[model samples]
Target: MDYRQRRRIKVWGKAEYVEGDSALIERLRIPGYPAKVERAILFHVEALSENCSQHIPIRYSATEVEAMMAPLVARIEELEQKFVGE
Candidate 1:
């Protein structure tokens, strides 16, 4: 069976737009960049339903993903070393 099919989850909620706090906005602002987010949206969940996982995508842990990319990272490093030597 597909991975996503193993788990099904649904969430129902009400969305509310709240004014952003000045301190939070300032903290989130990047230096030298204009502020973009002026407000925040909050979701008040009313219900959660778990039906099926058929639509969910498979997810890997950090370690698992790192292992998968180890060969590529090693190849890049080897190429960098060769480039530096030439």
Candidate 2:
């Protein structure tokens, strides 16, 4: 089970090779941290599977959340202004 008690699948794989530094590796490297990815282990999947996402909650992007709250925020501001004026 996952953190949210959602069922998940396990996988079996083998380490294929150690990946060397490249453009993709450099892009993955985080700044200001002394630790760097000297090499990465590539995996060869023997078998893989996943369970249904029926238990997972829906997620929203920043723009979507802002758009959803805009009307409520405008109404709140309008009320605040009316009370201040009185």
Look at candidate 1 and tell me the lDDT of residue 21. 86
TM-scores of the candidates are 0.39, 0.41
Model 2, span 13-51: residue lDDT tens? 998555675765777678877886776666788997787
* lDDT per residue (tens digit) for residues 1-86 in model 1: 33533675678999987675877667656788765778766689999988666567787778989999999999999999999999
After superposition, which runs of candidate 2 have C-alpha atoms over 4 Å from their true positions? 1-52
**TM-score of candidate 2 versus the correct structure, residues matched by position:** 0.41
Q: lDDT of candidate 1 vs native?
A: 0.78
Count of backbone clashes for each model? 8, 0
Pairs that clash in candidate 2: none
Give candidate 1 misplaced runs (Cα > 4 Å). 1-54
lDDT per prediction? 0.78, 0.77
